[model samples]
Target: MLIVTGYVQVEPTELAQFCNEFSALATATRRRSGNLSYSAAVDDPQDGRLLVVEQWEDQASLSAHLEAADTVAFVDRWRGRMLGNIEKYDASNKRGLMD
Candidate 1:
Protein backbone atom coordinates (compact mmCIF):
# COMPACT_ATOMS: atom_id res chain seq x y z
CA MET A 1 0.00 0.00 0.00
CA LEU A 2 0.99 3.60 -0.47
CA ILE A 3 -0.05 6.52 1.63
CA VAL A 4 0.26 10.14 0.58
CA THR A 5 -0.20 13.09 2.90
CA GLY A 6 0.20 16.79 2.49
CA TYR A 7 -1.06 20.23 3.34
CA VAL A 8 -1.48 23.24 1.13
CA GLN A 9 -2.02 26.81 2.19
CA VAL A 10 -3.95 29.05 -0.16
CA GLU A 11 -5.00 32.64 -0.04
CA PRO A 12 -8.02 33.09 2.22
CA THR A 13 -9.77 34.88 -0.58
CA GLU A 14 -9.25 31.87 -2.82
CA LEU A 15 -10.29 29.17 -0.38
CA ALA A 16 -13.79 28.67 -1.65
CA GLN A 17 -12.67 28.37 -5.24
CA PHE A 18 -9.87 26.07 -4.24
CA CYS A 19 -12.25 23.76 -2.41
CA ASN A 20 -14.65 23.73 -5.30
CA GLU A 21 -11.96 22.76 -7.78
CA PHE A 22 -10.56 20.18 -5.38
CA SER A 23 -13.98 18.67 -4.86
CA ALA A 24 -14.24 17.97 -8.55
CA LEU A 25 -10.77 16.48 -8.67
CA ALA A 26 -11.38 14.35 -5.60
CA THR A 27 -14.63 13.05 -7.04
CA ALA A 28 -12.84 11.93 -10.17
CA THR A 29 -9.87 10.52 -8.30
CA ARG A 30 -12.08 8.43 -6.05
CA ARG A 31 -13.47 6.63 -9.04
CA ARG A 32 -10.11 5.60 -10.47
CA SER A 33 -8.98 2.03 -10.23
CA GLY A 34 -6.51 1.15 -7.43
CA ASN A 35 -7.49 4.19 -5.46
CA LEU A 36 -8.08 3.28 -1.86
CA SER A 37 -9.06 6.76 -0.83
CA TYR A 38 -8.52 10.44 -1.54
CA SER A 39 -9.54 13.53 0.38
CA ALA A 40 -8.71 17.05 1.40
CA ALA A 41 -9.80 18.65 4.63
CA VAL A 42 -9.70 22.27 5.62
CA ASP A 43 -7.40 22.48 8.58
CA ASP A 44 -7.83 26.18 9.07
CA PRO A 45 -10.32 28.09 7.05
CA GLN A 46 -8.91 31.34 8.35
CA ASP A 47 -5.51 30.43 7.01
CA GLY A 48 -6.87 28.46 4.07
CA ARG A 49 -4.89 25.42 5.02
CA LEU A 50 -6.06 22.20 3.42
CA LEU A 51 -4.82 18.82 4.56
CA VAL A 52 -4.66 16.16 1.87
CA VAL A 53 -4.65 12.41 2.39
CA GLU A 54 -4.50 9.69 -0.24
CA GLN A 55 -4.11 5.93 -0.23
CA TRP A 56 -3.40 3.67 -3.20
CA GLU A 57 -2.81 0.01 -3.81
CA ASP A 58 0.80 0.58 -4.83
CA GLN A 59 3.35 2.82 -6.50
CA ALA A 60 2.07 2.08 -9.98
CA SER A 61 -1.41 3.24 -9.11
CA LEU A 62 -0.09 6.37 -7.47
CA SER A 63 2.13 7.06 -10.46
CA ALA A 64 -0.76 6.66 -12.82
CA HIS A 65 -2.77 9.11 -10.78
CA LEU A 66 0.00 11.66 -10.84
CA GLU A 67 0.34 11.29 -14.56
CA ALA A 68 -3.35 11.55 -15.26
CA ALA A 69 -4.24 14.55 -17.37
CA ASP A 70 -6.76 15.95 -14.93
CA THR A 71 -4.34 15.66 -12.06
CA VAL A 72 -1.65 17.34 -14.10
CA ALA A 73 -3.97 20.13 -15.09
CA PHE A 74 -5.12 20.68 -11.51
CA VAL A 75 -1.56 20.92 -10.29
CA ASP A 76 -0.59 23.28 -13.04
CA ARG A 77 -3.58 25.48 -12.39
CA TRP A 78 -2.88 25.74 -8.67
CA ARG A 79 0.90 25.66 -8.70
CA GLY A 80 1.25 29.39 -8.42
CA ARG A 81 -1.61 29.85 -6.00
CA MET A 82 -0.69 27.26 -3.38
CA LEU A 83 2.21 26.44 -1.13
CA GLY A 84 2.47 22.97 0.35
CA ASN A 85 4.43 19.88 1.23
CA ILE A 86 3.45 16.43 0.04
CA GLU A 87 5.03 13.12 1.06
CA LYS A 88 4.49 9.50 0.18
CA TYR A 89 4.96 6.41 2.32
CA ASP A 90 5.19 2.74 1.43
CA ALA A 91 3.41 0.37 3.75
CA SER A 92 3.66 -3.11 2.39
CA ASN A 93 3.68 -4.65 5.84
CA LYS A 94 0.04 -4.12 6.52
CA ARG A 95 -1.29 -4.20 10.06
CA GLY A 96 -4.70 -3.91 11.60
CA LEU A 97 -4.33 -1.54 14.48
CA MET A 98 -8.00 -1.75 15.33
CA ASP A 99 -7.84 -5.50 15.56
Candidate 2:
Protein backbone atom coordinates (compact mmCIF):
# COMPACT_ATOMS: atom_id res chain seq x y z
CA MET A 1 0.00 0.00 0.00
CA LEU A 2 1.07 3.57 -0.64
CA ILE A 3 -0.08 6.52 1.43
CA VAL A 4 -0.01 10.16 0.40
CA THR A 5 -0.64 13.15 2.65
CA GLY A 6 -0.34 16.91 2.34
CA TYR A 7 -1.87 20.29 2.97
CA VAL A 8 -2.67 23.18 0.66
CA GLN A 9 -3.17 26.79 1.60
CA VAL A 10 -5.91 28.79 -0.11
CA GLU A 11 -7.29 32.26 0.19
CA PRO A 12 -9.93 32.45 2.90
CA THR A 13 -12.52 33.75 0.45
CA GLU A 14 -11.64 31.13 -2.11
CA LEU A 15 -11.88 28.19 0.25
CA ALA A 16 -15.38 27.31 -0.86
CA GLN A 17 -14.45 27.30 -4.50
CA PHE A 18 -11.39 25.17 -3.77
CA CYS A 19 -13.41 22.60 -1.91
CA ASN A 20 -16.07 22.46 -4.60
CA GLU A 21 -13.54 21.88 -7.33
CA PHE A 22 -11.66 19.33 -5.28
CA SER A 23 -14.90 17.50 -4.58
CA ALA A 24 -15.33 16.89 -8.30
CA LEU A 25 -11.78 15.63 -8.61
CA ALA A 26 -12.06 13.43 -5.55
CA THR A 27 -15.26 11.86 -6.80
CA ALA A 28 -13.64 10.91 -10.08
CA THR A 29 -10.41 9.79 -8.44
CA ARG A 30 -12.19 7.41 -6.11
CA ARG A 31 -13.59 5.58 -9.10
CA ARG A 32 -10.27 5.14 -10.82
CA SER A 33 -8.50 1.78 -10.90
CA GLY A 34 -6.03 1.13 -8.05
CA ASN A 35 -7.26 4.17 -6.15
CA LEU A 36 -7.92 2.87 -2.66
CA SER A 37 -9.06 6.21 -1.27
CA TYR A 38 -8.81 9.96 -1.86
CA SER A 39 -10.02 12.89 0.20
CA ALA A 40 -9.47 16.47 1.34
CA ALA A 41 -10.69 18.43 4.30
CA VAL A 42 -10.47 21.86 5.83
CA ASP A 43 -7.54 21.51 8.17
CA ASP A 44 -7.37 25.12 9.30
CA PRO A 45 -10.25 27.37 8.47
CA GLN A 46 -8.66 30.46 9.89
CA ASP A 47 -5.55 29.82 7.86
CA GLY A 48 -7.49 28.59 4.89
CA ARG A 49 -5.60 25.35 4.73
CA LEU A 50 -6.84 21.98 3.53
CA LEU A 51 -5.48 18.55 4.20
CA VAL A 52 -5.31 15.99 1.41
CA VAL A 53 -4.97 12.27 1.87
CA GLU A 54 -4.78 9.42 -0.63
CA GLN A 55 -4.09 5.72 -0.69
CA TRP A 56 -3.06 3.89 -3.84
CA GLU A 57 -2.46 0.25 -4.79
CA ASP A 58 0.97 1.07 -6.17
CA GLN A 59 3.25 3.57 -7.84
CA ALA A 60 1.85 2.89 -11.30
CA SER A 61 -1.60 3.80 -10.09
CA LEU A 62 -0.32 7.02 -8.61
CA SER A 63 1.60 7.86 -11.75
CA ALA A 64 -1.41 7.27 -13.95
CA HIS A 65 -3.58 9.41 -11.72
CA LEU A 66 -1.04 12.21 -11.76
CA GLU A 67 -0.68 12.03 -15.53
CA ALA A 68 -4.41 12.18 -16.11
CA ALA A 69 -5.60 15.36 -17.84
CA ASP A 70 -8.13 16.28 -15.17
CA THR A 71 -5.57 15.91 -12.46
CA VAL A 72 -3.18 18.12 -14.37
CA ALA A 73 -5.87 20.71 -14.84
CA PHE A 74 -6.78 20.68 -11.18
CA VAL A 75 -3.22 21.32 -10.14
CA ASP A 76 -2.84 23.99 -12.71
CA ARG A 77 -6.00 25.65 -11.50
CA TRP A 78 -4.56 25.91 -8.01
CA ARG A 79 -1.04 26.72 -9.04
CA GLY A 80 0.60 29.51 -7.03
CA ARG A 81 -2.71 29.94 -5.26
CA MET A 82 -2.14 26.95 -2.99
CA LEU A 83 1.03 26.02 -1.17
CA GLY A 84 1.96 22.55 0.02
CA ASN A 85 3.96 19.41 -0.49
CA ILE A 86 2.50 15.95 -0.80
CA GLU A 87 4.64 13.18 0.61
CA LYS A 88 4.24 9.47 -0.17
CA TYR A 89 4.95 6.56 2.10
CA ASP A 90 5.45 2.89 1.31
CA ALA A 91 3.63 0.60 3.70
CA SER A 92 4.58 -2.83 2.42
CA ASN A 93 5.44 -3.95 5.92
CA LYS A 94 2.09 -3.00 7.26
CA ARG A 95 1.17 -3.85 10.82
CA GLY A 96 -1.88 -3.62 13.03
CA LEU A 97 -1.52 -1.31 16.00
CA MET A 98 -4.21 -3.26 17.80
CA ASP A 99 -2.46 -6.56 17.18
Candidate 3:
Protein backbone atom coordinates (compact mmCIF):
# COMPACT_ATOMS: atom_id res chain seq x y z
CA MET A 1 0.00 0.00 0.00
CA LEU A 2 1.01 3.59 -0.47
CA ILE A 3 0.51 6.33 2.08
CA VAL A 4 0.66 10.04 1.43
CA THR A 5 0.70 12.91 3.91
CA GLY A 6 0.79 16.59 3.07
CA TYR A 7 -0.13 20.08 4.09
CA VAL A 8 -1.41 23.00 2.05
CA GLN A 9 -1.74 26.48 3.37
CA VAL A 10 -4.05 29.16 2.11
CA GLU A 11 -4.85 32.70 3.03
CA PRO A 12 -6.95 33.07 6.19
CA THR A 13 -9.60 34.87 4.20
CA GLU A 14 -9.82 31.95 1.77
CA LEU A 15 -10.06 29.21 4.34
CA ALA A 16 -13.81 28.73 4.09
CA GLN A 17 -13.83 28.61 0.32
CA PHE A 18 -10.83 26.27 0.29
CA CYS A 19 -12.55 23.92 2.72
CA ASN A 20 -15.69 23.87 0.64
CA GLU A 21 -13.78 23.03 -2.49
CA PHE A 22 -11.68 20.38 -0.73
CA SER A 23 -14.80 18.73 0.71
CA ALA A 24 -16.06 18.04 -2.79
CA LEU A 25 -12.67 16.83 -3.96
CA ALA A 26 -12.26 14.52 -1.01
CA THR A 27 -15.63 12.94 -1.63
CA ALA A 28 -14.79 12.28 -5.24
CA THR A 29 -11.34 10.95 -4.40
CA ARG A 30 -12.64 8.51 -1.82
CA ARG A 31 -15.07 7.09 -4.35
CA ARG A 32 -12.37 6.37 -6.91
CA SER A 33 -11.17 2.84 -7.58
CA GLY A 34 -8.06 1.70 -5.67
CA ASN A 35 -8.51 4.42 -3.11
CA LEU A 36 -8.14 3.02 0.38
CA SER A 37 -8.94 6.27 2.16
CA TYR A 38 -8.72 10.04 1.83
CA SER A 39 -9.14 12.87 4.29
CA ALA A 40 -8.27 16.48 5.05
CA ALA A 41 -7.86 18.05 8.45
CA VAL A 42 -7.57 21.66 9.48
CA ASP A 43 -4.23 22.08 11.22
CA ASP A 44 -4.63 25.73 12.09
CA PRO A 45 -7.78 27.49 11.02
CA GLN A 46 -6.39 30.90 11.85
CA ASP A 47 -3.26 30.17 9.82
CA GLY A 48 -5.26 28.47 7.04
CA ARG A 49 -3.10 25.35 7.27
CA LEU A 50 -4.74 22.15 6.02
CA LEU A 51 -3.40 18.62 6.36
CA VAL A 52 -4.13 15.77 3.97
CA VAL A 53 -3.65 12.09 4.60
CA GLU A 54 -4.33 9.39 2.03
CA GLN A 55 -3.88 5.70 1.39
CA TRP A 56 -3.88 3.87 -1.92
CA GLU A 57 -3.61 0.29 -3.08
CA ASP A 58 -0.33 1.05 -4.87
CA GLN A 59 1.70 3.46 -6.94
CA ALA A 60 -0.57 2.92 -9.94
CA SER A 61 -3.57 3.99 -7.95
CA LEU A 62 -1.76 7.07 -6.68
CA SER A 63 -0.64 7.93 -10.18
CA ALA A 64 -4.16 7.63 -11.51
CA HIS A 65 -5.40 9.95 -8.82
CA LEU A 66 -2.73 12.51 -9.65
CA GLU A 67 -3.74 12.43 -13.30
CA ALA A 68 -7.44 12.80 -12.65
CA ALA A 69 -8.86 15.86 -14.36
CA ASP A 70 -10.70 17.11 -11.33
CA THR A 71 -7.60 16.68 -9.22
CA VAL A 72 -5.51 18.53 -11.75
CA ALA A 73 -8.01 21.33 -11.97
CA PHE A 74 -8.28 21.64 -8.22
CA VAL A 75 -4.52 21.87 -7.88
CA ASP A 76 -4.26 24.41 -10.65
CA ARG A 77 -6.97 26.57 -9.16
CA TRP A 78 -5.53 26.47 -5.68
CA ARG A 79 -1.84 26.65 -6.55
CA GLY A 80 -1.88 30.41 -6.76
CA ARG A 81 -3.92 30.67 -3.60
CA MET A 82 -1.50 28.65 -1.55
CA LEU A 83 0.42 30.53 1.14
CA GLY A 84 3.51 28.42 0.47
CA ASN A 85 4.73 25.20 -1.11
CA ILE A 86 2.77 22.06 -0.39
CA GLU A 87 4.81 19.60 1.66
CA LYS A 88 4.35 15.91 0.88
CA TYR A 89 5.68 12.55 1.98
CA ASP A 90 5.28 9.35 -0.02
CA ALA A 91 5.71 6.19 1.96
CA SER A 92 5.24 2.45 1.72
CA ASN A 93 3.29 0.44 4.25
CA LYS A 94 5.41 -1.41 6.77
CA ARG A 95 4.71 -4.06 9.40
CA GLY A 96 3.14 -2.58 12.48
CA LEU A 97 2.25 -3.87 15.93
CA MET A 98 -1.42 -4.07 15.01
CA ASP A 99 -0.65 -5.96 11.86
Candidate achieving the largest lDDT: 1
Tens digits of per-residue lDDT for model 1, 1-99: 899999999999999999999999999999999999999999999999999999999888898999999999999999999999989998878879985
Q: Write down the worst ten-residue block by lDDT for model 3.
A: 84-93
In lDDT terms, how accurate is model 1? 0.94
Native-referenced Cα lDDT, model 2:
0.93
Model 3 lDDT tens row, 1-99: 777877889998999999999899999999999998998889999999988888888788888999999999998999878854444455664678789
lDDT of candidates 1 onward, in order: 0.94, 0.93, 0.85
* TM-scores of the candidates in the order shown: 0.93, 0.94, 0.84
Considering summed lDDT, which 10 consecutive residues are worst modelled in model 2?
90-99
The C-alpha stretches of model 3 lying farther than 4 A from their native spots are 83-99
After superposition, candidate 2 runs with Cα above 4 Å error: none
Could you tell which candidate, 2 or 3, scores higher by lDDT?
Answer: 2
Cα error, residue 33 of model 1, in Å, equals 1.2
TM-score, cand. 1 vs. native: 0.93
Better of 1 and 2 by TM-score: 2
